[model samples]
Target: MNKDVLTFGVEEEFFVVDRDGHLSPAGDAVVDAADEEEGELQQELTRSQAESATGICTARDEAERQLTALRTDLAEAAARRGCRLLPSGSAPLAETVLPAITPNPRYERMSEHFGATARTSHTCGCHVHIAVPDRETGIRVIDHVRPFLPALLTVTANSAICDGYDTGYASWRYQQWNRWPSAGAPPLFGSLDHYESIVDAWLRAGAILDRAMVYWDVRLSEKQPTVEFRLGDVAATVGDAVLYGVLIRGLVGTILASEARPPKLSNEVLRAQIWRASREGLSGRCPHFRTGDLAPASEVLDDVVTFAAGALAETGDLDFVRDGCARLAAEGGGADRQRARFEKRRAAEDVVDLLAVRPARD
Candidate 1:
């Protein structure tokens, strides 16, 4: 395989809601009902959620097709069970009762150990996996990709509403997710050994249960030769998910081919940038990683696209990415679109209704 052209996949999480837009514990039923030839649908941390993952794909169209099929399958299955699949970062309305944890031994252990963090957590996210040759290259890509994560989060923020009220943040899921001790932005590592050393310390200190529990925004995949970006909320549409996946692949390809050193950013500033991205999405200013100066979010996004131009062009995804960015700019990020729907009807359920419909193929 060419190092500059990589295979990629996307995983998206969705909430199962009843026709009334209330959280439903139909995750297992939905997974069983959905067709899985295109992609896999599985039970998530909460019984109210289901997660879908595409198979390895070499191009943007391939990934998009799989994601669209998976979403359609999940939606149809949910409808059959009198529930709807809501693709959003956070639940727009509060559940009358706490969501039940999925009945799995690992999940049960997580709930027992993490307590409320595990129990009250029902947020959804989009994770992109890009293949690398080995662990060292994955680590290098993870380090280089660190500076762009906040911008990626901004573009993909979809969790504006939560618990029956406007959370005043684009991706409320980002906030909810960071409550995990091991979650959030990872440190820049000097080498693969350095990365493993930190993981060793965290495991020994009981910060994480195992290698799979390394919940950083970006990390090396434990089960694959890929770097997984756990940065953004589950996108609102199939187009949005494809846009994210292509951008990530482009960024990784660019990073792999370039000999440029990663930037040295302070942990404090990086966290603040992430907080801003989650809070504002594309509606407000984003801190430029190079200068630590705030700029319009759109400008920050442009910077990322410009940086990945060569790779995107090589993969024939440049046009797709450009068009997607334009749409996001005009219509706003997922969170912005959700709030628009809510403002029209002043009902949280309206947001659910808006998200439940799958977008038609272009």
Candidate 2:
């Protein structure tokens, strides 16, 4: 196997809603109904949600095909239970009773340790796993991608409301997930040993019960030879998810080729950048990691494209990535579309309805 191969996959979480489009705690039933060959459809932290992960793929088109099929399978499964699968990041309305946690020992420990953080945390996210041959390369790629996460969040933002009201933030899921003790931007790791040492310390300190709880926005995957990006909200459409996956691959490829030294910035700075992104999405400015200047989100995203040009060309994804981004910008991403629906109809459910349905291609 080529050590530099950028094989990747996407794991998406979705909420199960009833016929009326309200949250339903029927994930287990839906999962049972799903076809086994559609890849891993696992129980999430909440009974209201289920997650599907595609098999490792090398081509953007292959990933898209797998994701579209998996989503269709999930939708069919949910329909069997008389529920709709909603692809947004957070529930539009608050549940009177928090959804039940998956019946697993780890989740039970999380509930006991984290209390409300675990109970009220029903938000979903899209995690991208890109293979790295070794931990050293994984650490390097993670450091390079840290500054770009906020912009990526802007492109993928989908959580436009919470508790039946506008949250005013594009991706409210980020705010919810940030409350986790080990969540948000990770501090730079000098090497794999440094990363493992910190993980060990967190476990020993009771900050997290296990390696799985190291929920940084980006982290070295404990179960695979990959660096996982857990930043973006679960994209509301298959197109957006594919775009994110390609962009991530491009970024990693760029970093590996350049071999640039990681920028030295405080975690405080990165967290603030992430907060700004969660608040503003693409309509606002983004902080430059090295220059200490705020740039328009579009410009920042363009820089990402420029940085990834070589990789995109090598993978024959340049045109696909460029066109997809243009379409996303024209369609205003998921959050923008959600807000537009809400403004037009003055109903939060309308936003959910738009997200639940398959999106028309641009």
Candidate 3:
């Protein structure tokens, strides 16, 4: 297997809502569709929503092709029933509380464990999975990729806006996740064994249900031969998701290709910075993981993009990175856009209607 070559798969969460905009449990709908291979690409998780996953693809076009089809089927199904499938990292309405069951045993159990930690809104997230050749390679990738997680999050913080409110944070989903124990950044690990050792401690601590439930912003998957990045908020369109997909692959590849110099951090301080980034998004300061210095979030992103040039160039995605950053600057990213829309429309319905505009993938 080529250790240096990396590929990705995308799994996006979508809100399944009824005509009244009430959240619906769609785990059975999604999983059953997967079973028939006929509808929404199946995902195993909590139901008031559904997931559209991709077949492993070597290129962005292929990933988009699969994602588009999957979301279309799911959206059409929901629309047929006078419902809408919306992608958000978390539900925008803090008061819109719903049951968490998804009809899957894994989800049922996982929810029981983390439900206490999750927020009440219905938010969706874009989880990008990168291939890991085997156990050893997987461990190495996890060990080396910690510090860069913030740079990755800042570049893709689409949840800056959700529902009709600004929520005063960039990626509110991270802020939501921080409510649960064992759901934030992990301490830098020196080796796979060391990583697992921490997992073992969590298992023994009874704080986590399994190694798979560790919920790090970036974590090695327990079942898949890959790393799962859970940081990004659900992007509003396929273009946004793909743009992010390209950047994630580049970041991970850059880390894996190097001499394995682990990006170090002091957990307590770093965790505090993580909260600030989650709360402020790009508007406030972010922790510089490497130098442990304070800098504007934009400054932090500028440097990370520079460090990521080689990988982005090799993947033919450097332009996407540069352009995505420029677009964020011009548009103020998701949070800014969300706030502007709310200010203009003065209504959540209009805000969502605007977000529902499906951008053509051309």
**What is the lDDT for 138 in model 3?**
68
All-Cα superposition RMSD per candidate: 2.0, 2.5, 3.4
Give the residue spans of candidate 3 off by over 4 A: 1-4, 30-40, 43-45, 94-97, 111-115, 118-122, 161-164, 357-362
TM-score of 2: 0.95
Can you give the TM-score per candidate against the true fold? 0.97, 0.95, 0.87
| Candidate 1 backbone collisions, by pair | none
Q: What is the C-alpha lDDT of each candidate?
A: 0.89, 0.84, 0.69
User: Higher lDDT: candidate 2 or 3?
Assistant: 2
Task: Candidate 3: give the clashing pairs.
Answer: 47-102, 88-124, 89-123, 89-124, 90-122, 90-123, 90-124, 91-122, 91-123, 160-335
CA error at residue 3 for candidate 3, angstroms: 11
Q: Pick the candidate with the highest lDDT.
A: 1
What C-alpha lDDT does candidate 1 achieve relative to the native structure?
Answer: 0.89
Candidate order (lDDT): 1, 2, 3
Q: Mind giving the per-residue lDDT tens digits that candidate 1 earns over 1-362?
A: 34447898999999999989899999888998887788778899989999999999998888988988888888888888888889999999877799999999999999999999999878999999999999999888988888888889987899998888888999999999999998999898869999999999999998888899999999999988899999899999889999999998999999999999988876677898899889998878888757778898878888889889999999999888989888888889899999988888778988998898552321
Best-fitting candidate, scored by TM-score = 1
